[model samples]
Target: MTTWWLMRGDVRVGELRQYGVDQPTFLCHFVSGPGWEAVRELFEAWAAVQGPDPDGSRNAEAIRPLMDLGLTLHPSDGGSPLTCFKGCILRIYGDRARLRY
Candidate 1:
């Protein structure tokens, strides 16, 4: 039971530009702030769906939220059971945070 939630709007990473860079890079954002409970829920759900990867199952709940957040994956890359999320800002100007399981 992987639960997914997409971002409805552009995410804001505070304090950037000072370093002088371009676009921001992020895999995901938690608008409600970093709540460990949420992370745990997401992680558990993802793991459940992943099960034994040998079966080659896709976790819809986990992936849906990611897609809703506007996080686009490179065409060259395929999705995996491992969930990796990042709270990031412009390379040179913004800040960064990571959420992985």
Candidate 2:
């Protein structure tokens, strides 16, 4: 399993986890915060495009919204696999974070 942190600047807003090898399942858990609605919409859109399997071309399309929101993917440091998957990180834009405040 791989766990990714969804961060808005210094604050953490959500998490994503990937499980399985032959058939990987990605789960996203996000907290209520700025741009939450947009994020939710994007998730829904992604799901709609995903069909039965998440590893589809639409997956890339789904991630585009996140990038537009200034979210970048990063690799997390070494951690317990039971607690978190290794090398998974996503950060929200600082500018967007400030807008929420």
Candidate 3:
């Protein structure tokens, strides 16, 4: 299991926790912080996609938090990628952090 720091500058808001060969889980569990709202939005949007109709069917895309603002899809061992918003400042961690472009 690998846990990467989802950081915005020096402040750590959330985490992308990978558990074995399966898909990693987005741990957006935050209390109070500067970027806490963004993490909360992500957590809410992602939480809605949980569970399934036996075959794993879900509703609309969980990209609502990244609506008007920009988006970055970082790389991980998880099959379904995780979303982390670092405000307007865009910083790429090589191939690990990409703009989905």
- Say which candidate scores most in TM-score: 2
Task: For candidate 2, report its TM-score.
Answer: 0.40
lDDT scores for all predictions? 0.32, 0.42, 0.39
Q: lDDT by residue for model 3 over 1-101, one digit each (tens)?
A: 44444444556544434333322322222223455455555545545565664543343355444433433333445444334443322222212222211
Error of 1 at 66 (Å): 2.6
Of 1 and 2, the candidate ahead on lDDT is 2
lDDT of 2 by residue, 41-76 (tens): 665565466355556566676657655554433325
lDDT of 1: 0.32
Please give, for residues 3-55, the per-residue lDDT of candidate 1 as tens digits.
22222233321211122212343333232323333333443455456355553
* Model 2 lDDT at residue 64: 73
How many clashes in each candidate? 8, 1, 0
Instruction: List residue ranges in candidate 2 displaced over 4 A.
Output: 23-38, 50-63, 78-101
Considering only N, C-alpha and C atoms within 3 Å, which residue pairs clash in candidate 2?
A: 3-85
lDDT score for residue 56 of model 1: 43
